[model samples]
Target: MQDTLHGDSQATGSGQEEGGESPAMDPRLIAEVRQAAAGDRAAFESLIGRYQGEIFRMVYYRTLSRMDAEDITQDVFIKAFRGVETIRDPVMFKPWLYRIALNAVNDFYRKKRLRSIFTLFSGDREEGQAPEEDRASERLERKEFWGWLGKFLTRLSAAEKEVFRLKYLDDLGIREIAEVLGKNESTVKTHLYRAVDKFRCEKELCGFLKEEKP
Candidate 1:
């Protein structure tokens, strides 16, 4: 988790120069973070209300499990409430919060790996059985799209995958992504370029690329 939070202050920014399509954090959000850090419960809850959906979507894209995403999203806010004071710049709140989220996702994968090991040792695994689908039939179209996207993502290297998701799915700018992933801007761009080249080779994603063209 520390590895995901190790960038220098030079990587932090929140405007056009950052390459972020999304607007910078609202001035109101900056004030809310400051108040929350001062131990105001309402301020912290307001912060949660402001970003919960985006955080949940980030987790869901990575985990593809509704229950796991919800659980992790709650954990993220709890962790943030406890550690908000550690944040040096209130304007960097979104990237800092995303760093916490990325850490939570990493922890989830670690625990899942441990569970797999335990299941192997105990011979308790259910073989040749599909995992139960938790999504509703009404959301089948969305689920199918994510299913295909997940497969496409696997084709990217881990670094490329992270960059691609942050830049495209999360709508983060180059500098914001650099801060969140603790990478330099050049390294982030390299990964994004490679990921795009790989995506161009996939027939299924070609239409997506075309549709996204400006």
Candidate 2:
């Protein structure tokens, strides 16, 4: 977000970030969120109607995907809808909802990391490399800054990537990230430091990539 590898797309606030009802969402959504908390399926569906797009956008931007994000968004809602009934306070649902969304992103990344690892070991990657036309179709998959940043993320140990994604992509304060991640704030900061160091090194590599001149 703060560190753009190239063209920047503004990171708008999440729906709840609008505070006390988002214009982008129906006012009924507040009722629905509360209802879902009370085990109302119909109300939960209505809640999904309101903020699904926002959650999807967050996932898609960070994951650089639509299909994957779409699947994960549904997963987020299903988890939320089920857990909503157990949540004690409706007011706290916003962050609770986001935590679900974040988990979806993490799961998506884990699956991707596995795919990449498999591809690396299979030698079949050469036969399956993207065709030229496919490259154009998938171009948004290459937000220059994020594309580079993601490579570094993949290189990180699982704990480090989990910690870093919360700090940077989710923009959670270090303390908040520490709570979600079950680490000391100082430990979280160390992950952020390591992640940044890795990102800077990778950005340097991109300069070399650009120098290739086709």
Relative to the true structure, how large is the alpha-carbon lDDT of every model?
A: 0.78, 0.65
In model 2, how large is the Cα lDDT of residue 103? 74
TM-score of 1: 0.80
Q: Write the per-residue lDDT of candidate 1 for residues 1-214, one digit (tens) a residue.
A: 0012222323223324434444667788889999988889999899998888778778877886666888999999999999987877887788888999999999999998888898998988743222335323345645556666888999999999999998877767888788899999899999999998887788776675566558
For this target, which candidate reaches the highest lDDT against the unseen true structure? 1
Clashing pairs in model 2, backbone N/Cα/C closer than 3 A: 5-145
Write model 2 residue lDDT over 1-214, tens digit each, in one string: 2222342334433323311222343456667777788788888877787667667766766656556677888898888877888877555565577777877787877887788888888855632224432553455544454556666778898777876665555555565555566578778778778877786677554685676446
Q: What is the lDDT, from 0 to 100, of the residue 211 in candidate 2?
A: 67
Q: Score residue 72 of candidate 1 by CA lDDT.
A: 96
